[model samples]
Target: MADIVEVRNKQVIFKDYINGYATGSDMVVTSDATIRLELPKNDDSLILTKNIYLSCDPYMRNRMNRTMEGNYIDSFTPGSPIVGYGVSRVLESSHPKFKKGDLIWGLVGWEEYSLIKDTRTFIKIQVTDVPLSCYTGILGMTGLTAYVGFHEICSPKKGETVFVSSASGAVGQIVGQLAKLFGCYVVGSAGSKAKVDLLKNKFGFDDAFNYKEEQDLNAALKRYFPNGIDMYFDNVGGKMLDEVLRNMRVHGRIAACGMISQYNLDKPQGNYNLLMLIMKRIRMEGFLVFDYYHSYPKFLEMILPLIHEGKITYVEDIVIGLENAPAALIGLFNGTNVGKQVVAITNE
Candidate 1:
């Protein structure tokens, strides 16, 4: 057996409830938390894990505020380590489903080490040749989110025009490519010119525009979708949504994945054209990835081959260390990352 080792566990601690936009100051990186290497034998379900990668996602911004709606996810407690989806390797385990050296991806603390008492939400790494870092993005929750939102919520049809906002993002990138693979006409709107170019050239988006450059969003949509948008994969809400609603065709289906634009707002943005929902008879539905985890195997069954066969590609902007996690996380709101933002906690 490996000898027990005691070590300092570095953590990113939540400072307080947020008001407007969150900055790196909202989370503090500290090395004060410490843990023993030995796994506790009292509980059969306990798993001791060494975190390898941490995910920095837009939805995490929702948890920074104390006033969020109940039952979705809890607000991060002040002075406690911020928690999110992470890829980890089992250091030790008393759980039947896991053993030492087993790699899994699920919700875990933003720390070097963790004592995970619950294993139900975790999915073991079944395929290793694919980059393990992908577990934090394409191969993990982010991929599942893209899969469920596009295929499950939107129910896309071939030759249909599909519009995706935040189209260069982790989920949005996959959604656009999946739409193309389904024989849909895909157009995407991203925050920057580089991302817009990525959407058009790399992800195979039929057309893409930098939303920041467009003086009139509705006009841009009309220019891109002259016939009208048949399906809209909305990653940004607020004004973008309002404009898309005006340009949607009758019976268009909208999958509400994330509203990154509204995450940091003190007051959420309201839509003036929501009456278009009734006028066009569009179906706008919101979904949570947790509700669709049962389809993860199904997601892999489809995505893995595409990845290996080079039919699908993914990008990740990785920060090297846990200490830089706060800045990396805050960068999501600022559009600093061109693709999926992942923090490498360990070189392994």
Candidate 2:
């Protein structure tokens, strides 16, 4: 190899601990950041890669906080580069499973280049016909979330009445479609009219509505699920969860995934309709994708065929360049994206 050299790396740096919603102010992109062209030392399992696409997930907002007690992942260090799930191409590797030019998906930094220290989370990209950026959402963690939450946790049945909140999102879109494939009558609620269209048209939901237009959430649920819902895949919590509880059929099951509604809330509101759970004998469970990562290969086996046959479709709202990362992340909460919001740092 040539003599080691430092290269200027364009990076999005986390500036401080955030409270409430994460704003663009919390992060700053600097074009002058530098990284060595070679690995530092003796890290045989580590892989050096160039990031291609980065995911902007709601769960990542929790990682921007300073607390460690209630959060699932450790807080991002202030003044350091923030990291999340991403797709990258390995440029140099000491790991036996990877080599130069191998594309992989895993946890990576919000920089042009990253020295990925852990190999445990890494998954070599085995398929490429689909958009490479898709690995950041569907075909990656988001797809796994829907598979485990709906099929495993919720245990959907044929002819069951299902509902999905935040239905136009990465996981929500897939979850709704899976419910339909399972022979369930599915309804989904989104924040905007465009998302409502995407849910009903692209993802093939039985019914979809813009939640913002509903003055009474309970009434909206009643209109869609007149017979009451059998299964609910919850992405946004807070009022949506409470309203869903009020409309669930007896023996209903709820798979609680991410609570994007309460992600930025410092003092989260309690659900008043929770008593309906006891009355209806409903089962509500919260799940993390990490718990079902072992089944990822199986998930790929199941979805790849559906994708190939055009039985399933995924929508992505991708923004180009690492400099625009902050706006793309903040836009998730603002209803600015049609489907999954992904930042394309590079295509290589």
| TM-score of each predicted structure versus truth | 0.98, 0.98
| Structure candidate 1, residue pairs in collision | none
> Looking at model 1, which ten-residue stretch has the lowest summed lDDT?
65-74
User: How do the residues 1-348 of candidate 2 rate in per-residue lDDT, one tens digit apiece?
Assistant: 567778888999999998888799899999878888677677788788989999999888888888946667889989988899999999889889999899999999899999888888899998999999989988999999999999999988899999999999989999999999999999999999889998988899999999999999999999999999999999999999999999999999999997888878887887899899999999999999988889999999999999999999999999999888999998988778889999999644
List ranges where model 2 is wrong by over 4 Å.
1-5
lDDT string for model 1 (1-348, tens) is 567778999999999998999999989999888899987767899999999999999999988988677639888999999999999999989999999999999999999999998788898999999989999999999999999999999988889999999999999999999999999999999999899889989999999999999999999999999999999999989999999999999999999998999888888888899899999999999999999889999999999999999999899999888889999999999999999999999775
Per-candidate alpha-carbon RMSD to the true structure: 1.2, 1.2
**For model 1, how many clashes?**
0
Please tell me which predicted candidate would have the highest lDDT against the true structure.
1
- The collision pairs in model 2 are none
Model 2 weakest lDDT span, ten residues long: 37-46
